[model samples]
Every structure is written in C-alpha cells, then in structure tokens.
Target: MRISKRNLILGIIAIILIIIISILLIKQFSKDEKPDIKVDEKKQDTLIYNTNVEGIANINNIYIYGMHLNLSGEVNTTSDISSIELVLFNKSDKKRYNLEYEYIDNKVKFYLSNKINEGIYLDEILKGEYQVLLKITSSDEVIRYYSLNNNTAYSYMDYYTITRNGKNNYIEISTLSTQMVIRVTEKTLPKDVYDITIDPGHGGDDPGAVKNDIYESYINLEVALKLKKELENLGLKVKITRTGDYNPGNIAGISPYGKGGRVAIGYETKSKLFLSVHSNNLPLYPQNNGVEIYTSTNNNKQLASLIASNIVKETKINYSSKKQDKVMNGVYVRNFTTSEINTFKREAKENNYKFYETINTKTQYYYVIRETGGIITGAYVDGRNKDYSANLYYNSNIGLDGYLIEMGYITNSNDLKILLNKKNQYAIAIKNAVKEYLNITN
Candidate 1:
C-alpha cells in the first residue's frame, strides 16, 4: 500500500495502455461487422414486361425502297424500365433491324429508317416472315425479353392472341402492303356495271375448233355480238376482243395485234369480269352436243360450276353428256408440253405425299382438279396433303371471273341450224341460263 510516486505513475500508465489495447480490439471487430448486409427483397417475385402489337398490315402493298416501318405497341412493366429497344428480324434474309425509342406514357412508337441499303427487292420482302423482339432493362439489374412470332406481314389485319405462360393478351397490327381480290358473277348478261371485257376466243390463226365449213370462230363472233348488244343495252361499259368477221389485225388501231398489242386491255381499268365466247366441236364420230362452260385457272371454280350447271339446266341438255369436270384446261389450253405435264404431275405427287403423311388415305389423279390458274398456281395445295408447290398464273395477278362458253358443236348439222337461227330455242335457253347465273330478274 505504501508505494513511491514513480511506482504509482507506472501502474497508471500500464492501466492506460491496457485500455488503449481494448479500444483498438473493439474498433478492429467493428470493422468486421459486415455493415449489417441489409438486402431489400423485391416486392414482386418476378419482374415481367408484357408487350402487345396492333394494326392492319399487308405485305403485298409494301414498297421496300425508301420505305420505313412504323411500330407501335403497349408495354406493361412490373418495374420501372431504364431503357428499351425493339429488334425486328427479317426471316427471309436473316437480317436484323434495331430501333431504339424513349418510353412515354407506358407505350412506345418506333420507326426504323429504310435509308440503309439492304439490297433486298420489294417482291422478296413480301414473301418472308417478320419477328418483333422487345428488350427491357430495369433499375434492379433485371432484364426481361419478349418476342412476337408474326410470320406473314398480311396477318397484321387480324387480331393475334399472345399467351405467355398461362396469361393471355391480344395484338392487332397492319403491314405496309396489302392485296385485295374482287370477283363478279359469271354467265349472266352484264348488268348496268361499269367495266367489262368481252373476249371472243380463237381469233386470227388460232381458229379454236373447226367443224365442216362452219368455223367455230364465226359462230363465236355472232353470239358475242348479240351478247355485246344486250350488255350495251343495260348501260354498262364493254370492250370487245373482236367486232366483225375478220382477224385480230382487222381492228385497225384498238386491237391487240396493232403496235400497242403488249398493253393488256382493262388492265389499268377496274374490269370486273372477262367473258370469252366460243363454240366447241367434239369428235365428228360421237356427235356429242351440249353447252360447256370454262373458267380461268385462278377463277372461282364454285362460281364456274354454278354457271355451267345453270346453263345445262336451262338448256335441258344431257348433264351426263356434258363434262361437269374441273380441269386445269386453262393452263393446258395455252400451251401443252410434255415437260409441263411432267412438272405438274411431279408437283401433284409431292403434294399428295405430304398430305397423306399426316393421315391415312390414297391419292387420286384428276387432270382438271390439279391445275390452278397461272397466277394462283402457288396457292393450290394438293387436295391430298395440303402442301403448296406451284401457284396458278391467274391468281398471281389482279383477276376477275373469266368464263369460256362452248355454245354448241359445229360438226353436227342439227346443232349448226340451232346456232344460226337468231330466234332459235337455243338462244332462249342461253338467255335463261344467263338470267339464272346473274340472278337477274328482269
């Protein structure tokens, strides 16, 4: 207890040193505290961004040169998005078009400039699928991606149902191009319609079918003239392929054989129908006489059949004798070759095989049923497998209902007499058939 002053100071210094060591240890442990590692759990378990597209779109009318696509869609984001970009992929060429747009009012309108040289033709652009991809970035380092599968640009006109997982949404959009097809009633006398093209078949060197001295072409012209008179009386516009008993060259200036023959009549004008009149001659031995109607490959077969049936019914001709056949006659009639026939057969076989692959059935070979109009040849699928191979020629362009009427046989003397008489019962029968087919009451 009785210590010196120096000893007391040393003890106090030792105690101070001990206190400093403890404070240092406490600070070292405090540095290792990990700062509580506070983690704020996200309110939503999964951040999702739902996207939708809308509009009427058609690919056919789209011109790619200097053409831009306008994209507008609504996005529902679970969290605030920092940035968003739309990715458009052209499936045809495997090319991508990226467009960036700022978020506004929970929606975005994006425009992709077509100024870049893609070296893609407008026709090729119409043939491929287009995909729309949406990428969204959020503040929480979470990224959500959404994609829409739009194969054809023309499908934009219809409502698209998008189901993500189990959730359902709708999208409507339109492409820049669209194609429209208009058809008119056939076999009926032309009503007070505006545009019409009357085609008298087998002109010039192509005299269609001949029988004895009475050429099929001559009879065709006579009936066509009568039809023209009736059509003109109805206050309708009409263009005749031939007016008199002469060759196509005789039309002087307005005919196709003239200098401007390449220019197709009624092509620029909105023609509703093309009626080609002709008289068919069967084999001289059989003496088969009846009315037969033919339509272009791309024309509506149902309508053609209706007109043909009405003609047969009105004339009281033997339905059994008349070939109620759907033939690809239009294509073959133009020019028939062995190569073309083989190609057609091969395509038909492939289509048939594809169709039966999914189902169990045998394919049948029918000539007329297999051929489509030159334009619509691509749209024709083998009725067996539904596989598309070639398109019809007529379906490829803006087309109208075309009719080829075989009035009577010129080979038979009895048939010749009926056709020559202007007031013959055959003419009355034809008039009644026209009335029924056109649905004309008067």
Candidate 2:
C-alpha cells in the first residue's frame, strides 16, 4: 500500500501502451476483412429490327408492342425512359399513325395498329420490293434515316391491260401505291377454226345489207355456226366472233359497213390461216350464186390460195376473177394485207400475183386486199372471174396456199339451200377444201 509515486506512474504508462497496441491490431484486421468491388468489362449492346440494318432505336434493350409491326433490340444505357414513340405511314393514302413504344430490361418494343389499305397492298407486296421511308427521332431533336431491306411485308394493288402491234402483243401493269407502270410483250397466234372469229356483217342498230327478210349479219352468223361444227368434226379448231345473229358493237377500231363490222377470233394455233366467214352482197344484181374465198393480200397469199382452191375443189363453187384491190374494211384482213403485203411485195416480186386483186375494171381499190396488204382471191366480184382466181389470191397472201371460200349467196334460192343443207355437196366440198388446205395427205 505504501507504493512509490514513480512506480504507480510506470504502471499507468504500461497500461496505456497495451491499449494502443490493441487498437492498432483491431484496425489492421478491419482492413483485411473488407470485400473488393470487381470492375465490369465494357461491352456494346446490339439493337436489331426485323433483321434490318435501318431500324430506329437510340438505346438497346427495350420492349415495344405495336399492331401491324414488331421490333427487337438490346440496350446499354442507364438512362430511365418510360416509352418511345414510333410513327408509321400508309404510302398510298398518305396516312400516318403514332405508335406507342414500351421499355423493358435492356429491350424495346412497339406495335403499329393502323388498318392497311387493300388497294395499296398487292399480292406481290410481301416480296419486299417496294420503297419505304423510315424516320426515327427523339424529343431532343436527334434524327436518323434507315432504308429497309427487302424483308418488310406490305400489301398492294395491281392493274393490267393488253394490246397488240403487228405480231407483237403487250401486257401492261400498274400499281396504285407507287404509281409505277410495267409492260410485258410477247407474240401470239389465232387458236382454231372452231374458235374462229365469225364477224356478223352488222347488228345492234347497224343492219348490214338488208334484202327482204334476209339480213347479211344473220346469214353470216348462221353459216359460221354451221361451218364451225363442220370444222370441229374435221378435228380442226374453230372460234366464232358472233355466236348469235347480233353484233356486240364495232370492235374497238372497226367500221360499221359489212367490211368494217366483221368479227375476228384469235387462235392459239401454230397455223397462220385466218378464215373470215361471210355472205357476199352486191349493189347491183342480188342474183349472184357461188361461194367466194378471200385471202390476205400480204405474205399469207399462198396460204389463202390453198384454202380457196381446196374449198373450190370440195364445194365445186365458181371462183371469181383475181384482181389487185384496195382494202377498206376488216381490221385483221386490212392490217395483215398492209403490213404483210407491203413487206412481201418488197421481198418477192415474182410472187406478186399471189396477192389479191380487185375486180373493179375501173379503180384498183379492193378495200380488204388493199387495206390488208395481203393477197386476196377465191370468189370473184363477177361471174366471169374464174374459180382459179380465188386460188391465186391465197397463193399470194399466205405463201403457203389458202383461200376465202364464200359459202353461197343468200340472194340465190339454190345457193341458200346449199348453204342450209348439212349434207349438201357444197358442204362436203368445203370440208374437203379445209383438209386440202392443211395438206393432210391422209
């Protein structure tokens, strides 16, 4: 109890030194127990839209749901955004829509709800060959443009038209969305004799060559129907322009006269013969009785001659004289003559006789022949014209020998009877003529 002050002071000092050591030890242990925060490697997030390079997105990883459209992408930004707005437009009607965008963890999505116009969406639109404008912008004025690839789906409307120039045929197509026009052209031929185009002289307000109770249009159609059946039996194709005794109207660019108002049928045939069935009517004497055959005055004159000769041989009908004539009617005949004949005459002068000639001892204007530029032959304008004259026209026009066989005259009682008789000698002759024209040796 009687301790010295110095010793007490030493004891206090020792205690203070022990406390300091303990504090230092605790501090060291605390430093060792703490865990370290690892640094994350920087990686770029990718944003892709419909597998297209040009999609609108500022940040990656967002959710967007929309009607008519869908989007997908990834986001790397830490910015907090509730939604993005997408604008869609209808290219055809120029209509627009504001689509709502949704955001999820690192993903954005949107939907387009506008009803697509049918007229603008063609069946081929899904092919993605159309041009579209994509605009992406934020409220802060940041804008971007993207040209979508052929992956986008679309709806469109298509319109088409068909036309012919010479042997060349053209088909035109138009689109309402882009207002673009496309054209396709190809060559075509007539189908068959059954599918033959029988142009009734006139009807539906235009009565052609009326004589008593007989109308040329009615006669022409009747004969054509009979002839169609005959040709069909012969295993030949036939098509009639006029099914009944009526006329639809002047075909596109034809005339009202018996010459202009005739009908034509196109064949998908390899043969180049065009048979125009008709009844002959004259201005002076209504007593003409015989069958007449007309052929193109153009390159098909030979074919025409063959047709005429066969018809004559089979029907035993008299042929009219062969003469140079001007064509004034029948679009196909006139066109064939003009285009084909003009070219033929220039190429083969020795075969010029193959062309059809007019019987007008006065003017050399054979309306059909002249207009067609093809050879015309078969039935003559006058009784004096030989039946062989018709053959000459066919020979000249087609170069393959053909003819225009006028069945018989409606004005002549005997001729009319022959035309109406199914088993008449003339009918047999006509059938034989077609066989001969085709050159079927059997």
Number of the top lDDT candidate: 1
How large an RMSD does model 1 have? 27.9
lDDT of each: 0.42, 0.38
Runs of candidate 1 with Cα error greater than 4 angstroms are: 1-194, 249-263, 266-269, 296-303, 313-317, 320-340, 343-374, 377-396, 422-442
Candidate 2 Cα RMSD after full superposition onto the native fold (Å): 32.6
| C-alpha TM-score for every candidate | 0.42, 0.35
Residue-wise lDDT of candidate 1 within 1-442, one digit each (tens)? 6999999999999999999999999998877664533222121111111233232221222111111123334454546766655533332214344544445575543333222212221112222234435555677877665553333333432211111122222222333222111111112222322245566665656576776565677777777766766655444456775675555532443333222221134232224445667666766444766556654332334444554564455444433244434352211112234465466667758655432221111111211221211122111333432112222221323333345566656665565565666423433444445444444444
Q: Candidate 2, residues 151-240: lDDT per residue as tens digits?
A: 212122122111112232322332333222222334343332121233334555556656677676766566556666766666554455
Q: What TM-score does structure 2 among the candidates reach?
A: 0.35
**Which ranges of candidate 2 are over 4 A from the true structure?**
1-200, 251-271, 286-288, 298-303, 306-316, 321-404, 412-414, 420-428
Error of 1 at 49 (Å): 25
